[model samples]
Target chain A: MAAKYELKLGAATREAFGKALVELGKENENVVVCDADLSKSTFTHLFGKEFPERFFSCGIAEANMVSIGAGLASSGKIAFVASFSAFVLNKGFEQLRVNVAYSGIPLKVVGTHSGISIGEDGPSQMSVEDLSLACSLAGFTVISPADEPSMFALVKQAAYHPGPVFIRAGRVKVPVIYGPDQKFVIGKGIQLTEGTDITLISTGLMVAECLRAAEMLEAEGLSVRVIDLHTVKPLDRELIGKAAAETGCIVVAEEHLVDSGLGVRVAQVVAETSPCVMEFHGVNDTYAESGLPEEVLVKYKMTGADVAVTARRAYGRKK
Target chain B: MTRTSDLSELQSIARTVRRDIIEMIGTAKSGHPGGSLSAVEILVTLYFDVMKHDPANPTWALRDRFILSKGHAAPVLYSVLAETGYTPKDQLNTLRRIGSIYQGHPDRRFIPALEASTGSLGVGLSLGLGMAEAARLDKSPSRTYVVLGDGEIQEGQIWEAAMYGGFHKVDNIVAILDNNRLQLDGWVKDIMGIEPLAEKWTAFGWHVIEVDGHDIVALQAAFAEAEATKGKPSILIAHTVKGKGVSFMENNPKYHGVAPTKEEVELALKEIG
Candidate 1:
């Protein structure tokens, strides 16, 4: 169970996104940013500070910002719009569906403060359903980068990707797993630890927790496979199917609701390829009260220990 | 600007497009005729006179973009697109038929010439603003025109786009309010009061110009003024009558979404002729 790799202190994905956006703007002049009066909170203010002319503060207008991003994407520039996940996905969902997704425009929709991690924001600000909302739309590439390294790389990838993209970013700063030289491709999952007993698939901040859970499980004489399923929509179905066939059981962990998030996507892949037992670790069909990120995770049963317990449950059900 | 000094030519094209709208909706048996008819002059003035567009190259980089934000009036947009050679004139009869390219609303997937696919109201202004912003970024000398319904503006998102467009000074965009006064339920005033409409636009940082929606010459002049009036987005509050041009349907909310009967279509065509 000893730590296999030294995990460094990392910044929030939103911070990584803001830094990456400024970097992208320096390289590509067509990279434009717009925010719905949340530039400071969403960290898009960094890009605004560096590229004043390229950034737009669309006031408290999420729908307008979304369509405006689509319009900019349609013409020539790659537009990246940011807002709180609750407002951007829920309030401006129709605009995202029609203007961006239906029209097939490459607009980067960055939703920060996703899940119940934005401590003290209450249920209203927590975007527990954004993953489902974005995945419901056809032709949308949804990604939830695990850490700062992946978030920066994916932000760059979304700019060149010629379709709509929805990126779920967290508010809490977590442990960094990947190095600066690490590369990532869209719709692909990276296996951090390889084993054959049970596959533990996690995304966003949960990937770091799954790494820790894998350590705990390996110490108990269990062969655990850990996968960073950052891309949730166009899920690495081939990898998931292989995991299901080889391991005979799987456990999915996400910071989102359990119903239509990563667990449902994994279930779909396993059902189609290798039918096996699966357990989900997430917000179990309930809203969380305002609290610290750690307390909320403990209350909602979303910690590394929770993931290990779910993996053990899946492991027990394996026939 | 191919502004025909011969007013009769523009008037003739408008009259023919109005007839096309009536016949198309009449054949469909389920479409909005009143709004379609009310917006005839605005559409004609933009496509035939004011806007710079090439029918041969619909996606021309410097071409002016028009968005029918009042999407229920698809008949008017379709007729104009057909007249501009974007769609074949014969395809006008297939207005809402299954397997036909023409739907009840303007969908860019079916009609490539359509600048944006809009059916749900109040979203087009934001889209047009986006295009205008893009044009500004690209330094492309193209303008974006958005036609909005009076009732559609009550959707709150319109005001959001208005504020953004105004604050950002999206001068490359011009929003035309088809202030036909009539909505599906009743008059826009009776349903939801939008009084002091001109002042609202001005306060939102727009150049407001009130004009007669049915007058082709006035519409052309207003559009010219909108293009010349730089530093802010311009809104032409086009005062129009519902079911404009037809005696039985004029200013009538009942015909907002109902198609014309066969006999009424004949009488309406005779009236336009």
Candidate 2:
């Protein structure tokens, strides 16, 4: 599929969460949200405003917030739990693993401000390995929605889909990619461009960066195929296999640790299915220092130029 | 105007539930028997007497909710649910088997009646608080009951939940602590003591009731007192023996999760009889 430039004058990924949640509320009254005092920050407060009765405030208790989410789900309610990735997926990790994921409750977790993207808010607030933590759960579907439209589609999908889901969005507004009518499926990858030089697979905010990187690479006569892998758990194995077979080289970019993040999940599947030379671009196992979001992203080597270099290296690896 | 005096019949039913717990775990040759036996009275009371729930329709929206926080003791729950007709008694034997809906831990996907996956302790009460608070918000008149293990309460999260339950004035939530003293490691007192238990509940702004967990009437009374309390959440600190009915494993940590052998199960059934 050819890359379609999204109009991003003011739209961001986090707003899409609120926009879609409002839409979900119109369709299902059972749609509810529980926030751990980060309702506005994560945009879950939108659901609260639309469906006041269905909203629950845990008042900064992330662990308790998850417990409440599990309770609502038990009563056959569709509950979306929202908080910062640091607290929701990290502090509330045990609760997520035992209470929701293991229980297989219809709890959809939406965590914003993940990775170094939280920026000057400092290291404590940022979540560098949120994806690694959530992806480990056996039945959990880990997603890092790239643009606004995909976030909307995934939220609707999560509301109807069974089991636990982690929807990773960033506080930083990303470009709006798909229109309202764009299609989305769990375990399916959206192919943005086609190329035989190398396949660049990116997740979350990194997808937008890679898309820009792909454009730059095209100008340099290097054909790069960019895949926005929003869902990281079921991990579009078919698309990945096909990419490895055709492109023969891959670069995995994410906003988490290089150790066990989306890159590692891709490694596991590629190693078993089709072996390919792959380079991972992510936070290199070190916590971020206080800086702006853009500055930290560059320092952490997760910017578009960094991905472009990694894509070139991946292409270079292909005999 | 009188609730049926099914005391004798209920007593026998409790005995039967205890037997079911031991037999099912021993047959499966895996499960926490001590904790399961310890919670039998509480389960019997909820299923046979207390807790407004429809066994026929476990998914009833407005039904009162319950979460077994100390999920290691799932055999007791499986047995009680069977007795209540949520599932056939025959399904009890399929526990802990691969592909069996029943796993080592309670899974909501497998059992709709189960509120959350529990094995990790001190979490069920928080979940119950959510349900109870939701009920309050909806003015649904339905209550929430969460059962926490004595050892499980040692977790710091339990204290967090206890504090939140009171701060929110979750009157509809009942936190039941099965004070069985024994945990997976050893006697809870030796591992880590939870002293001044009643005072602890009182400090947390809960209407505290301490009772003999094995005595059905004491439980019946305590539950009523909880309902009557105003402006506070309730906690029924149930004093119980770890392995109550089975003679060999009573108050013994060895039986915490070790499945009884065939010979042991036979002896256990005979002893209960």
Candidate 3:
């Protein structure tokens, strides 16, 4: 089945997360959803509407919501706690770290409106360091789906995962890159395009922008490979290593802080295995102000044009 | 009131658990004895009479869940668990050891009987509420009991959880506040006075009851009352001496986190006896 929206502008990943939760709720009565007053924004309200008994609103308390999710998980129910990335990971870091992570329980921490894409809400709302916080937690598997279809797929995967998982979802709607039937495997990256000169590794909304950047590079007589590193923590080492070896150079892009997100993770993978020249494209270690999502991307150097420029720099640095 | 024989048995068990807590901490040379000593009768009543749990079947889905939100009081939980046959008696001595499952804080990963891993204070009530919610979903009568420290209530998360439990009408959650009145540094009032505590919980819509924590029968009746209350969660504000049973340690903040010396442990054990 095709997406209901225009294929060029798909729904937000949070919308897909909400829909998938409703589906899971129907399939398993044991599935429960918790939200910290962002049920509408996080899209968990859809699940709430479908299964009111299974949904819990923790008000604006993300810390309580997180530990409650742990409580549900411990008692043999799949609990998905959704909130803005910054509030959930940064504000509720201790609860997530101790109650969920240390217990090694299976809790799906859906951090919506991640990265600088959650524009107009100011830098405080943006989750630029969410990946860093999740990575610091032991036994937490982190996944940031590139689009709506993958968000639903990865969320289903997270439900079945035995340990804690953090899914980073964006606020803005983007192009429909994956099909309705696309399957997502956690801890793996997907290669969207093939090129020889430079591999563009990106995640979340940046995947679509990276694909656009690859098209732009191809038009200029350059070969640009685009790979979506959906799973940030596990860091698909084999795919990144192969891309680094084949492409010889890599440009990492994301709508997150360059120091601690997909870029730094991809750089580490390549640094350990292939030792390729890398150019980073992301929020350059500074807070981004409120603006349109696209404008925020441009200002943070995380747009399609930014990826293309960084890819060129990586290609130039190649031996 | 609980039967005289039952209360006597529970009181005896509390004394044993108190001695065990002192010995466990005194042997390890590092633990929060004051808090553990304060929470003795609360845990003993819950494990021995109030809760529906089997030591052999700790993972039974319908078993009541008890989370030590004030994780520093692991000595009390460990001692109680040992007495209840959930853990081997020898394991109590191995607490805080490198390879021992008896961690300084309750780690559910290492100890399966523990409902949640908690050390960083103020998260347990939320966890208990979640378990209670899950029990509601499953249509199970199983309840969740969370033990909190007076000092630990200073964490904003506890109040946040209190609000959620009250607003959600989570009646299956019964939180017992170990109001030992002392934290690691000093008295709770001097550090952060949480006075009118009963009014605060009542305002949050919880069925609040204050009881002398050392009274086993009173503790048991409070648990029964908590279970009897409907449409809202309950809080048993257990008024307790910081270092109960041990004369020298009573109401002393110095013993809050410091273990007793071997001689002090002997004296404390004799006092408990």
Q: Which candidate is the best by lDDT?
A: 1
Cα deviation of B226, candidate 1, in Å: 1.4
Per residue, candidate 1 scores C-alpha lDDT tens digits across A30-56 of 999999888888999999999998898
| Clashing residue pairs for model 2 | none
Q: What share of the true interface contacts does each candidate keep?
A: 0.71, 0.67, 0.95
Question: Which residue pairs collide in model 3, if any?
Answer: none
lDDT of candidate 3 over A208-316, digit per residue (tens): 8888788778888887788888899888999999999998999888887788877788888888999988888888788889999888777777778778888887787
lDDT of 3: 0.87
- In candidate 3, position B146 carries an lDDT of 92
Kindly list the interface RMSD, in angstroms, of each predicted candidate in the order they appear: 0.8, 2.1, 0.9
Each model's chain A TM-score: 0.98, 0.96, 0.96
C-alpha displacement of B212 in model 1, angstroms? 0.7
TM-score of 2: 0.90
For candidate 3, write residues B161-248 as lDDT tens digits.
9999999899999999999889988989999999999999999999999999989888878988999999999999999999889999
Return the TM-score for each candidate structure: 0.97, 0.90, 0.96
Q: Which stretches of candidate 3 lie over 4 Å from their true place?
A: A1-7, B1-5
TM-score of chain B of 3: 0.97
Which sequence of candidate numbers ranks them by DockQ, best first? 3, 1, 2
State how far residue A102 of model 1 sits from its true place (Å). Answer: 1.6
Q: Candidate 3: count the clashes.
A: 0
> Relative to the true structure, how large is the alpha-carbon lDDT of every model?
0.90, 0.83, 0.87
lDDT of 1 by residue, B53-125 (tens): 9888987999998999999999999988888888889989999999777898988888887878888888999
